[model samples]
Target: MKQKSTSPWAWVPTLYFAEGIPYVVVMTVSVIMYKRLGISNADIALYTSWLYLPWVIKFAWSPLVDILKTKRWWIVVMQLLIGAGLGGVALTIPVPDFFQYTLLFFWLLAFSSATHDIAADGFYMLDLDEHKQAYFIGIRSTFYRLAMITGQGLLIILAGFIESSTGLEPVEFSVTTQSTHTEWVVPQAKSVTTGGENQFVVTQADVVIGLNKLNKIQADSIKDWAHKQNLSNGFVIKEVQLEQAPGWWSSNVATPLKESLKERFGKEDKSAMFKGEVQGNIAAFGIRLAQMPEEGENVVLNLDRQSGAKDLSLVEGHRLTFNNQNWDQQAWVLVQADPKLDTAVSADFRGLSGNIPFAWSVTFFVLAILFVVFLIYHRFFLPRPAADKPVAESKNMLNEFVETFVSFFKKENFAIGLLFILVFRLGESQLVKLASPFLLDAREAGGLGLTTGDVGLIYGTIGIIFLTLGGIIGGYLASRNGLKYWIWWMTLAINLPNLTYVYLSYATPESMWIVACSVAVEQFGYGFGFTAYMLYLIYFSEGKSKTAHYAICSGLMALGMMIPGMISGWLQEIVGYQNFFIWVMICTIPGFLIIKFLKIDPTFGIKKQ
Candidate 1:
């Protein structure tokens, strides 16, 4: 008796949707999360880009899926594994050392997702006949694109929402200080206040300043004076009340102090100062104190002479007091202040906020539940076809692997083809790495300064819809006119629209419309152009063991994306976002050059009509 066939409609959409999720989460979503968490562009690009390893080498293990269990079994198993991996990532994200720990789960997701791709594609072939396969191919592509929306767009939008609700803010602050000094004297005392509380509380009442004529102040005398005054190495300025400390607070607060000292004392002054005194001063006293001036309250320091010059009182001590009730509780950090210096000290800390960790836990928890749902739905609804005989015995596994590797290199124009595949998306790979970061970064930092939610609305939701539309239109056009005719246009589509970034970086437009339109245009081009690359991979993998060969092609595709992306952050840092985008456009030359030698069939992708 003939076996009854299952309808493709029941499972095809969900199958491709499942396939799209982990890949997007790994490749795209992780980048955004890291960027938002303030991981440097270089580290984010390098570390996350390494997650692409599994997809690049996945072709090496594709033969195992064919040789071991049935494709259906592998599909279900891999789906469950992917779900576990996603949950692992979500769980680890809120940890103290989340970057390292979360990366481990991302690797797991990447590898499992790649394996699922192999099995799912194989199962598609085995479960459907030629006519049904052709009929549902578009449907499969559509659902996969939907998966992109879900993963890249909807999930990111979800993350952006969670970010808003969770109360995660970048650690940053700024302080503006002004002082009244009639004569230029070295900085003697300073105090910092935060939220109406004295943070670096300096007991100015007991603080003393020693002032002597330059000729009377000898080196030995100064040393003896420092010792008698209980200045052990120097005064220790403690950070008393830290309302919101940024990540780099300790390292950066002293930077401005050092700069101020460098500006004040020339080379001669440096030589006259005690050995390592500059460093010691910075280490001992780095915190700045600023008190906003009050209308009737003038904070003044009055010094009274002791008895005579012989009383170890070469300098007079002053008691400085201020009424705290009249002062506003805004953020004010005091740096150097002189009773006579002409310059004012200003300290600004950007990207600092409350230390509240956003509610990312909820996002991941829901995702885990969603994956469980996917797992249960697939298990019950997916058809289990009769298992095909394993293609290789356990002993032949090594030989089959060798054949799979060797045969790919033996293809016609293989070297040129490989080069084309590798460089085709070189620009795009780098662009995608920093796209979210460029959007979320402050406008002063060469970004659009969009909020996390705004990034989701513009790039994820609006941009992805156009991307999906572009894919559909590209498919229709390729079917009508064939892949060969549209190859050049597709190549242009992939590379040219990177100009949107270049434009955004230059204009730094505040209007959301400009940003949204720009993202839409670029994403649409990406979707439309990507069709050629996919069709080309299919064309190249048409020979013996086409499935395995296609797997190899997919590996190359991943490798292409991986290598360029790994260095994109460092590159962006070297040349700011604006120039980095220009460099991306420049890198597209190789793709154009390689495409010249490709041998495509004129009618390969055309429809029967």
Candidate 2:
């Protein structure tokens, strides 16, 4: 039967778009989500960085993709596998052991996604002729980047919106008051006016007893006496009062007792009589009320009861009695709180108080659904190619695998070439791992203090555009002048913008434009400089087994990224963002030094005139 033909356009964009999603989710989106979910940066970096393992070792199974199934078959199957993995992650996210469980699914996603990449790349070459391959490569690449935007930009912003909506606002303090008896229940149904709105709040406040040093005077003479004693701000007033004998104007009250009396009463009320009978050495007993806030000032009193003894201690229960030597009393300090907090209620459900599992579950499920759609669409539109044999065909699979591994090491300067590829991106790998956290962390934590949405907008959307533009420009420049002339410049390009991160760490700019520009500059340089790295890999892979060698090189590239990224979070947590970025700049030195010794043909990666 003759095969039905399908245009490359019918599936190319979606094909590459599907290719980019799982990779971005496994590598980047997971980092951001874990950070937002309060996973320590160390764990996030360590675990997620390990997800790179699949990509690094993908060459091990590259032959299986060609031998076991058709390229089109592998593509569709991997899509379904990836989709299933995503769904698994979503299901595990809300479970009790979500961190460990979700990571297990992420690993599955990563391996499946890497396999998908291998099959898709092979299928692209097999399906299209030479001219069409060159023509549509950019189209495929553009859609791949668009997938990044969807994952990093739109998806993250959605996560942020859900987070804010479900998250509880911070608590504000109300007022404090002293109760003589420990008999007060927390005063309920209290209201306050805040932000031009009236709200009832549940308030917790601190109360002091015995002697309290005060700023505003409860009585004027007490203020004057406090001033005369060189006591400013406020006077220390005791809970109980001192007594003078009845009709004792002529009786000189002890000067020590005089000070205590004046301090308590602001001056003796000579006309006032002791109402209740006092026992031995007794005067009067009561708690002096602190001058309250102005009427209509929305405030609630939090009463703190304490024993009115020499040692002011918290009251043990709702009631306390005075002994012959002392009286009982309490005092408190006031604090401000949001009036709107009055209406906020704590969630009684299973830890749904702060996190919205439904939101994340829906997001991941939607992503899985999209892949299902992709799987269905491609199954229909993607044409099966006639040439389905492995690029290097052999009857013995083990022999082909051994040959693939051994041939890479047999190449000239293989050690140095491999080393260059492995370390060229060392600084960049660690930098990318920590950049999102630094951008999203609070300013006080030595980060940019940007919201998730802002990070999505600036780094994901704006930065990606510049990165792509830089790559295009870099490709043009390398083609015209060759990789040799631009190699050192490319090294500089890749390494220099790293200082922008250092600058950002130090400046901690709040302005989104400044942040966007900084990220743009850094990403552009990364895109531009990365051209030399890619070309060098292609150049070194030249040989009879070029395809397998190139696959091995890509594996090493992933390894380079994985190792540094694995440690970056721990390093960032230890040294902090500012110093961590400085460390990233320092790591660039090895790459620069390695490039100095690289042997490159002047004509490499250049088209001859």
Candidate 3:
């Protein structure tokens, strides 16, 4: 058969772009989605971290791709499967068991995406000669990054836009702090009344909270009560109880399990609650709809500070969900004044009732359509190269695979090399999983309290730009000085800037620029330091069966990320974000320690003169 020769430009960029999307979506985007949907941080981290398993074990099945079918055939079929998996996720997001169903689909997406990676990478080598392969490496990387931007930046921005736009006319209110002391008294309960459907009614148009700090005992009492109620520390003037209890699983199974775990592992530091001399003053306001939502419809009220004094912040009630069963029940919004505030200052807050699931479902649907497009485009445009054929000696493939594994294990300093690969990103593996959740968490929980759009703008666009710049600079410097001279510096570059997250956790600064800059510093450090890690992998994978050995290293890298990420949320929930970041800094010690045992070629990564 005559081989078809299409321009590499026709397929390389698109192929890589497609390759990058599902990865970002499965690994990063899913974390953000579950957070917005009100899943507990522990659950989000644990379940989503499991999604990395496919990538971690992909090497085990990668040989099948070479043995069974043409690389092009695997590519086209995987894309089709990927599209179907995305569609499955989209279809399940609105169901009551959405989390379980979406995760099942995500597993499918993860495996398909991993398989596609092997096939795509294999096809790239088979279709291009050595020179062209070297030339297009940068092009392929650029498009992969573009895919990252689209998934992490543009798609998230789109979901955020829908979250803001698909809701009721937003209600804006302001709260002012007065120096005049008002006695802390619970407000009298008002008679409940029903209003028209979809009418969101606020009991108070605006509020005035006194600047008086509660005495330590009173403050401690209020804090304890609030903690018990799963509310922020505030003056609970009027208690609003749910009309109906939660489902049997929540009350019977999940709650008991959580309490038992909390008892065993979560020891709270009472002293930390009242760190300063004076406790902040807080007040609660009520919000309820006039009538119940229609069947299968849920109205979610998201409250955010619009424009205001930083001293006056919304501490709780950032998100409230109302359905037919609970539309009339009053939900409380807790506002807290800074301990240092003695003057009159006001902050404005806006609440919007957007359907959260619908927004995410639409995002997934768009992804499904995109993958379908990729499937169709690659099916026709991908060149049919004579070299892109299945292995002829299928029976010998298993032995070759076993030998590939044995060769890697027999390499010099194999144990040390394996340790280096596994421990290099110890701090990072945990941080990546919690960073978005920290941004989205409520102020009372010690997060930055950023909206989804704000996170997308800050972490995705601005942070990614700095990360890329750092990587480029790191690569150039490595080419000039080689990996040995720069490895320690790169190690410091990666680990030290993690302190930015520590500062962010402590300050929780409301300024978008401050948050963006912090994330930029951390991401830049990661990018720069990551260059050394990659160079080391390439160095370690040298000699016979280098390609297969490299794949094993990559799988171990994913395993390193997966295990730490799985526990990160559980740890964060126990110690809180402030301490969790400090722990991340402590974890970096091992990565630095492991580097001392590594032996590297002094000239590796240097451009030969």
Error of 3 at 391 (Å): 5.1
Best by lDDT: 3
lDDT of each: 0.64, 0.64, 0.78
TM-score, each model?
A: 0.55, 0.54, 0.65
Instruction: For each candidate in turn, give its C-alpha RMSD to the true structure in angstroms.
Output: 16.3, 21.1, 8.7
Model 1's alpha-carbon lDDT is 0.64
Of the pair 2 and 3, which is ahead by lDDT?
3
Error of 2 at 279 (Å): 52
* Segments in model 1 whose C-alpha atoms lie over 4 Å from true places: 1-7, 21-53, 80-111, 124-389, 393-395, 434-456, 502-512, 569-582, 607-609
After superposition, candidate 2 runs with Cα above 4 Å error: 1-12, 24-53, 84-107, 123-142, 152-365, 380-388, 391-394, 427-462, 476-488, 499-519, 538-548, 564-609
Please provide, for model 2 over 1-609, each residue's C-alpha lDDT reduced to its tens digit, 9 standing for 90 to 100: 898888988999899999999999999999877754546556877799899888878888876675565788889999999999999988988887899989999999999998898788767766764334434544666788889878977887676455445533312222232322222222232233344322222323232221222222222333244233222212122233458665554345534454553455342232134211111110011121122324432121112211121112121111111121221112122211111121211111011112446567767898899999999999988987787555445468777667667777889988789889999988999999988888866555677756544676877678878888877677667766777888899899999999999998888876879889989999999988887787787678665444446667788887889888987885666556777788899999999999878898887655544
Clash totals for all candidate models: 14, 5, 0
The TM-score between candidate 2 and the true structure equals: 0.54
True-structure lDDT of candidate 3: 0.78
